[model samples]
Target: MDALVLFAALFVSVAVGFALGRLSRRHLQSQYPKDYALNYYKGLSYLFNEQPDSAIDAFIGSLEVNSDTLETHLALGNMLRRRGEVTKAIKIHQNLLARPGLNTRQQHESQLELARDYIKSGLLDRAEALLLELVKISSAYKQAALEHLIEIYQDENEWDNAISAASQLDGKHYRPKSGLGLKQLQAHFACEQAQEDMAQRNFSKARTHLQEALGFDSDSARASLLFARLEIHQSRFREALDHLHKIPQQDADYLIEALDMICECYEKIGEPKALQKYLRSLLAEYPSNSLVIKIAERLRWLENDYVAADFIAEQLKQRPSIRTLNRLVELHLPHSEGRAKENLQLLKQLVDRVIEEKPSYCCNKCGFTGNSLHWLCPGCKTWGSVRPIRGVAGE
Candidate 1:
C-alpha cells in the first residue's frame, strides 16, 4: 500500500512537470515546444514500460534550466535518488545548491537533497556534515535531519551520539502513533551501554545502566530481562525473581522469556516446590506449549516417566506440538529396546534437527531472526524489539 501511494505521487509529479514544461516552452518558436512535449511523452512511455533508468535520463534531458523549471529539476533529481541513481541525483542536487539566485529555504532544501544523495552513495562523512548543518538551521526538516543523523550513528555504532540525536528531535512533530520516538530511542542507548558493561563482566555497572533504561521507559522489557539475568548471575535470586515478574506487566507477550530463567533462580535458591507452584499457576493462566513442556520436565525429575508421559499427553491434546511429541517419545524409549527404541531415537534426532535450525530470537519490528539475543536489532537498528521465540521449536 505504501509503495503504491509513493508510485502514484511520483506519477503525479511527473505529470505536473510535463504540464509546466509544455506551458513554459509555448512562448518559444516552431519545433521547440513540439520536441519538448514529444520527449515528455517518450519519458512517460519509458517509465510505464519499466525502463525507469532510461526514463530518468530522458526526463532530465527534456527539462530546460530556467527559474520556472528549477522545481521540476529538483523533483527529477529526487526521483533519480528514489530510483537508486545516486550519482545522477547527486550531480543534479549539487548543481541546484551551487545556483546563485536560490532563496534561503530553497538552498537548505537543496542541501538536504544533496545530503540524502551522499547517504545513498555511501559518503557517510559528507552526509553527516550536511545533516549536522541542517540540524542547526531549525527548519521543520530539522526532525528529518535528526532522524538521518541517528541512522548514521547507528551504522557507525556510536550509541552515545545516536542517543543525543534522537533526543534532539521534536517527537510531537512526527506522526503520533509511530513506536520509534525519543523515549524508545533513549532506552535503546542505555541498553547498548548495559550490553558493553555485561561484556566487561561489570555486573553492577550493567545493572545501573539497565536501571536508567527502565527510568527512561519503564515498559522496556529488554531492560527488565537484562536486569533479571544480571541478578541471577550475582546469586540474588529473590531480586532476579522480582525483575522477572516485571516482564508480564511490561509486555505480556514477553512473559515466556522470564519463565526458564526464573525457574533456574528458584532451583538455585533451594525452592523447587515454589517454582513448581508458580509454574502450575502460570499454566492456569497463560498456558504456553513451552511452559507445558518445561513443567513436564520438572514432573519427570520429581516423580517418574509415567507421570511425565501422562502430563505431556494431556497437554498435547490441548495444544498439539512436535516438541511435546518428541518429549513423549523419549519417555517411552527407556522401557523399550530393539527396533522400537531405534525408531524413537531417529525421531528424536529429526526433532533435534528441526529445533536446531530454528532461530532462538526474532525482532518484532524488522523480522530479523537469529540464534542469540540482540538488545538492538541489527537489521533496523531499533531497540528492545528482538525477543525470544516461543512455540514448538523455541523457548
Candidate 2:
C-alpha cells in the first residue's frame, strides 16, 4: 500500500514537471531533448510494471530540477526518508543543495533535509556539521537544528552537549508535541551526569550536578532519588530522608523507587518506630501493594503473624493484589495445621510464581512492560513514562 502511494506521488510530480516544462518553453518554440522524453516515457513504463525503484530513478533522470520542481524534490526526499530509503533520500537532498539556482531559504531547507537524511543513515558527524552550520546561520531552522543536535547528543550520552542544545531551545516558543519539556529534559541530563559522578565516587561533583538538576526542574523525582542515594552513600541519613520524602510529592508513581532508601535511612538513624509511622502514613495516602506489604511486615515484627495477616486481609478488601495475597498466605502458613498447612504452602508457592512472572513496571505512553523501571521508555522514547505497574498484579 505504501509503495503504491509513493509511486503515485512520484508519477504526479513527474507529470507536473513535464507540464511545467512544456508550458514554460511553448512560446520559444522549443522541444524537450530526445533523451529527456525517452526517460520520461521509460519512467511511466516502469510505473506500469510496478517497478517503483526503477521508476523513481528514471523520473529523477527525466526531471530538470529548478525553482518550480524544488518542492516536489523535497517532498519526494522526505517520503523516501519515511520509507527507510535514507541513501536515496540523501541523494535527492544533496542534489538540491548542489543546485546554484536555489535562493537562501531553499538552500537552508535543503540543508535541513540533507542533515536529517544523514542522521537517519547513522552519519551523525556529517549531520552535526550541517546542523551546526544551520543553527548558526539560519534563523528559520535554528530551533529544529538544535532539536536534532540534542537527539544526537542524547544517543551518544554526551549529557553536557545535550544540556547545551536543550538550553538553546526557546522555552516560550518551542513547545514539543510530546515528551518532556526542555527544562525537564535538561534536568534528566543533569541527573544522568550526577549518576556518572556518583559511580566514580565523586560525591561533591555529584551533589553539584544534582543541585543543578533541581534548579532546572524542581519537581524532578529522579533527581530527588539520586540526591537520596548520594546522601545515603555519605552516611547522611537525615539528609537522605529529606530527599526521599520529597519523591512522593514530586511524583507519586515513583514513590516505590524511594521506599528502600527511606527504610535504610530510618534504620541508619535507629528509628524503627518512626519508620513504622511513616509506612502507615504512606499506606493511608498512597495505598499500594508495596506499601501494604511494608506495613504488614512491620506489624508482624512489632506484634505477631496474626496481626499482620489481619491487616493484609483488611487491605486486600480495598485493593486486591496478587503480591499482597502472597504475603497474606505467607503470614498465615506457619500457624496452620496438617492438611490446612499443606494447602496454604501450595497456595503460597503458586501465588509467588504468579507475582514473579508479572511485570513490575509499565510505560504509560506505549504500554511497554518490564521487571524494572526505566525513566526513558524503551518502546516510545518518552522520558519518565515507564513507572511502577499498578493494580492487581503489581504495586
Candidate 3:
C-alpha cells in the first residue's frame, strides 16, 4: 500500500512538472522575463523526478538572485536546519550572508539563522561566537541567544554561567523567573558546593549549603535527607531525629524514607521501645505499606513471629502490596511444611521479582522513574521531584 502511494505521488509530481513547463514557456518569450520562469520550471522538473540533487542545482541556478529573495533564502535555510539537514541549510544561509547589498536587518537575521544552524549541527564554538556577536547588534535576538547559551551551559554542567543567564532573563516582560527553572539551578549549585565540602570533610560548610537549599525551596526532600545524614555522621542523634521528623512536614510522601533513620537515631539514644511506641502511633495515622513492613520487622525483634505475622496479615488485608505479601511469606517460611513451604518460597520469589522489576521511585513532574533515588530528576532536571512510588507495587 505504501509503495502504491509513493508511485501515485511520483506520477502526480510528473504531471505537475509538465504543466509548470508549459506555463513557464507561455509566460516567458515576451519580455525576456530575466529567465526566472525557465529556471523555475527546470527546478520543478528536478523535484518531480525525485532528484533533490538536481532540484537544488536548478533552484540555485534559477536565482534572479537579488536582495528581494534574501529573506526567502533565509526561510528555506531555516526550514532545512529544522528538518536536521544541517549541511544543506548551512550552504544556503552562508551563501545568503555572503551576498552584497543586504540591509542591516537582513544581515542580522541571516547571521542568527546561520548561528542556529551551527548549534543544530553540534558546532558549539562556532554557534557561540556568532550568537555572542548577534546579541549586541540585534536586540530581538539577544534574549534568544541568552536562552540558547543557558541550554548549552546546563548541558555542560556549568552552573555559574547558567545562574547568570537565568538571573539576567528573570523579572522582565519578555522573561520571568521560571520558578522550577531557577530553583533547580540553585539546588544543583548548592549540591555541587556541598560535594566539595564533603570532599574536604568540612561538615559545617556542607550543612550550610544544605541550609541554603532549604532557604531557596523548603520542600527539598533530598536536602532534608542529606542534612539528617550529616547530623547522624556528626553523632548528633537528637539533631538527626529532629531533621528526620521534619521530612513529613516537608513532604508527607517521603515519610517512609525517614523511618529507618528515625529508628537508628532512637537506638543510638538507647530508646528502642520508646521509638517503637512512637512508630506504632504513626502507623495508626499514616498506615503506609513501608511503615507497616518496618514496624513488622521491629515487632519480630521485640516480640515473636506470631505477633509480626498477624500484623502483616492485618495490614495486607487493608492495603495489599507485593512487598508486604513477600514479607509475610518470609515470616511463614520457617514454620511451614513440605509442599506448602516450597510453594511459599516460589511465591516469595515471584513477588520479589515483581517488586525488583518495577522502579522504586518516580518523578511526579516529569514522569521519570528509576530504582534509585535522585534528588534532581535526571530526565527533567527538576530538584526534589523524584520521589518514592506510593501504591500497590510501590512503598
RMSD of each: 5.0, 2.0, 5.7
**Reference-based TM-score, model 3:** 0.74
- Badly placed stretches (over 4 Å) of model 1 are 1-67, 176-178, 357-369, 374-395
Please report, as a residue range, the 10-residue window in candidate 2 with the lowest summed lDDT: 28-37
Local accuracy of candidate 2 as per-residue lDDT tens digits, 236-267: 99999999988888999888888889889998
lDDT for position 29 in model 2 = 36
Error of 2 at 19 (Å): 3.0
lDDT per residue, candidate 3, 248-298, as tens digits?
A: 767777788788899999999999999989888888877788899899999
| Model 2 local distance difference test score | 0.88
lDDT, each prediction: 0.79, 0.88, 0.75
Query: Candidate 1, TM-score vs. the true structure?
Result: 0.81
Best candidate according to lDDT: 2
> Considering TM-score, which of the candidate structures 1 and 2 is the better prediction for this target?
2
Runs in model 3 deviating more than 4 A are 1-46, 49-82, 90-119, 128-139, 171-181, 196-205, 277-287, 363-367, 375-385
Error of 2 at 246 (Å): 1.2
Per-residue accuracy of model 1 over 255-283 as CA lDDT, tens digit each: 77787898899998899999999888888
Q: In model 3, which residue pairs have backbone atoms overlapping below 3 Å?
A: none
